[model samples]
Target: MEINRRDFITKMSAIAALSVLPSSFVAAMGNEKVEKAKPKYPTLKCDVVVVGAGPGGVPAAIAAARQGAKVILLEEDNMPGGAPVDMYVPFICGGPRVGVFQEMIQVLNAKHTIGGRTCETFGKTGSDGKNHWWMPGSYAEVIYQLLEKEENITLMCAAPVVGVKVKTSGNRNQVTGVRIMRNGDYQDIDAAVTIDATGNGLIADMAGCEYMFGSEAKSDYNEPVGIEVADGKVQPCTWMLISERIKRNAILPIDKLKGSSAVEDNLNRWVKADDKEDMIRRDAGIYLHWGRTVYCKDTRDPLLLAQAQQEALERLQENLEIWHEAGYAVHLAPKLGVREVRRIKGEYVLTANDLIAGTMHDDVIAHAHYSFDVWGMKIPEEMKHIGPYGIPYRSILPTKTEGLLTAGRIISATRIAHSSLRVQPICSNIGMAAGTAAAMSALNQTGLRSIDIKQLQDRLASMGLFDGLKKK
Candidate 1:
């Protein structure tokens, strides 16, 4: 006779106790079946849960903690630093790097700078006009120190969020927390508010939230620039590396490299350099190089990404030999620099027009200043350096989702707008806003969308988040 699942389990449990009985009695029940053990998931509760402790998530967690919220910062990697540590993208691109991002950079400039001149004025926004990059491990060191200082933050590294815990109510999904893979079993961390700072919108995507992937046609968002038709293309993946001179006085073979630009440290800004030799001579101990770039068949797929990385490595063989012959050792990044992924659709989808016009929204929480630097897409030189634009609060709130917020480059924006704000500093600022907002939602027992916008703005402003843009 067939037994129900519960009854079967109960009977199997009773049979398990039969091991203490006589062998004859146990043997008589040989036809009894035993069920395989199922994995048990442990549950945890917190005020705020921030996933992906990179530039964005770190600040988000810190901001929430500072607001008196018990924050749990989850990172899939063993350490906290995001792209800079994992992907070796230690280069700083866009500007107005204020708030928690500014704090980290200040520490980086003071203690971790490899080639740049010593920063006399800490926390100043590009006043020195010096560009700097630290060793990849330096970022991790600084991030760890910053996170450790926050009393309310519980950081969990190597905790990958495999699933999202949500409560569904008619078309809307309210995110409660996340399920992370831990010790071969699932552990759920339930929080009042969840922030998706995964940079790829992984949490939001897992929560059944609608998201946009790939390039959208110019007509889709009515942006000023973009292709006429949606090409389903994205920015190419770059494999970055740091090269150091193993032998004393060995020159970097910049001229021999093809398709890769050898970026020497802060002698002169590499962005607009007229004399490469002069810049190299000023400071040349270490150099950051864009090793190789390749277009993945599908960036969202792990197999395709691996294949693309293999292709990039194949292309970089000649350069690797060149560097080795020059007595330089190259440290390849642990992961490929993926530029784009899922963009969760929010209440306001930022577009190129918002950036071009520098629209200052009433609910502006963060300010981003960067040019349209979409890889593989050619933009007019004149339109490249647009003025600072505002990132509204609505842009971080995923559509129809409660108790959840989007942070980093994955926040709501068209592809054109994303290309600019996707940089580290801007992403950090956005994360700070998301974290602060999340804390408010958790403590006040209010929905993410129902929080007072003015209060959020005031809190952000007090934190120096609004210092980047001069309000009109």
Candidate 2:
């Protein structure tokens, strides 16, 4: 009761220090110190683990499951459909949309066509050249139906892969599986083959695999088309949205909008005099609009992405007012449409030359046929629409990494080459190839590189994946 001021201060500091300590240690203040235990995460085993249930991951999961591998498909979002469901990018851009992708598109065309056009050609290339897109929710429905049919696939939604379980030795990494966040704790999902289909190459990057981000100079890769000097700049992010005609008989204000494009359900640009009457007669109320595009300071950073989205929304206010006056309501996407991210380094980095020359690699796993559609850069007119080119099996196999494969737009490719193959169809095909290879590797108990390329090619060929290459 007669404590001095100095003693009181000293005693308070000691109590503060003890308060920050663990309860067990604090309880043993004058006794033997207790050691803190390391956190133990629940571990789940599977034959193959596919992260990100977007265009690439979904197909990868389905393909692997079809090949008799137990697949655990994880999606960060609550639903499975990737860009289409999440980003409102429901339009199909690239071609050679065969294999599991073709199947999905066929289902979308038959059941989910919003343009009031009957699709006569089922599983036909390009759906008989009829450009079409579905409502974003339709894509989710179709994906759920397709995924449900697969008995060997376990679809886990709202599960994000936060880390990779990698074994490293002398600059070489063997990805055993991935760790996901679960119930405020970490849960490990071990697999024989792990597919980095996160679209950002997050898992591969975490696994200590080398990755290329942003633009590389033309001289660096000897690419046919790219900037002379490397800029490390990625394509601008777009905020995609859909506008619906709310009021009856209200004409779409396409001419007044400066940045947005009003398209028909068939994805055909709405021409003023050419098809206005026909469009109104069809009662096509919904139109996909490219809301606003802005370059993010650093796309890899979530905060930067959010800032870019805010900037886009600010820029979109004028368009939003215009649409409201035109009796239309807009539905913005859940996330910004990111065009590029980490392109994980692989055995072979595909270049624009390969796309232009239509190089059919000996181990071609997928054929991508799309125009060079660089958002910020202007490609030559002739170089715009190149012939069908092959995506080799080597391109999906990350260099110096075993049991890990890259899928979607994250596969190794120069910026110019990525502009061509980064679309949904091409990505889906790549996912199919990656999934099949993953299944093969898991079932055979062999390394990814040691798998039979010839057999893989034959399997893809049988699925009509090579049909596009044959047409050329």
Candidate 3:
């Protein structure tokens, strides 16, 4: 502690040396740098290229592959399951009958994750008595694997598609392929047909399709209550968690992070508030009830992220301690729940009215659920859950994107309707439609508009999407 000029000079010299050496080179100086290793093989390609590895993209990729087309499923993360494996989103709906979706369930009954496909919950009865469903999780990975291992399908993990280029045909536009972003490099994927299952509608939007966002005000698309308009108020995104193999079977008890103001105390709390009219019923593991929740502020804009990170950690720990005292060993979830962001507007804009009215389309291809959920612009500090809705094949087929089709939350729907139809079962149904539709589109080499609806319907019926509620 009493070292003087000699030691100080040596210490300053070391510091100066480190400051001059490039960061990575400094590590190499002390055998700390990790040498980059090259892959044994080169890049791969496919006929169909799908971006995003979310629940929606998984099945769409599979459907495309099963259709005898070479396919590539690209996921940004190294792993595949989107919300379940990454965001810990629970619940999968949209199924009212028997099909591969159901069969996939029967196969995954043992593991918490179906066949290691990300999923949650045991079987739950539905308002539609005919359906018994579980919220699928890593199950998407199972689905991804099943598709990728097929002779025709390939998977590109850790690749994110950031750019899109569209080619035009006679009055119809086609997506020739996508340019995937991998760090500083761009990966080009060329294909005849592209499925825009990027969850937030990146592909479809880039393809020059029309789109909208946020819930409509009560005066717009008339619901059971009134017409709702979607402005920029998006649903709150979930920093979700999905932890498993717990020591106790009880759910992690987290209500009010210890010293935070209670719901009653926060009469005008800016941190956590929601629409008073929104339904807050508990569905899946998430507390669907409306009221107070954590609202992490942009409290550290002038400071370092480390400080903000510490504050957030403190809040979480404070909440966790309360549960631990109550005899529940709470596990931090592996992923966060992603509620919303970026849905591509396609040839059609699906409105809540379209779902509520159950608009029959000559191009009808897929069906959805009853929940019309919205995430923002309410008085309560909670998400507004409406009932489910249905999706039509026409919604996926871009009016202009001839060689492309959209699926899942990005389909042509109003913000309110997208909220309704964006759940898992509905997303899977869209996948079903995409596969069949892709096949149809490929075989005839026609625009999606030219596909015979009668033929599509017949194909769906044959594939058991329209089969009995239970597999025969």
CA lDDT of every candidate? 0.80, 0.79, 0.53
Put down candidate 2 lDDT per residue, 316-432, tens digits, no spaces: 999889889999899999999999888888899999999999998998899888889889998889779886888988899988778899889999988899988999989999999
Count of residue pairs whose backbone atoms collide, per candidate: 0, 0, 46
For candidate 2, what is the TM-score? 0.87
| 2 against 3, candidate with superior TM-score | 2
Pull out the clashing pairs in model 2: none
Which one is best on TM-score?
A: 1
* Model 3 agreement with the true structure over 325-370: per-residue lDDT tens digits: 6444433434334455455555556675676566755666765545
* Candidate 2 Cα misplacement greater than 4 A, ranges: 1-41, 116-123, 265-283
- TM-scores for all candidates? 0.88, 0.87, 0.68
The residue-level lDDT of candidate 3 at 147 comes to 59
Top candidate, metric lDDT: 1
List candidate 3 segments past 4 Å from native.
Answer: 1-45, 113-141, 168-172, 182-184, 218-230, 242-317, 323-335, 376-389, 468-472
Ranking by lDDT: 1, 2, 3
TM-score, model 1 to reference: 0.88
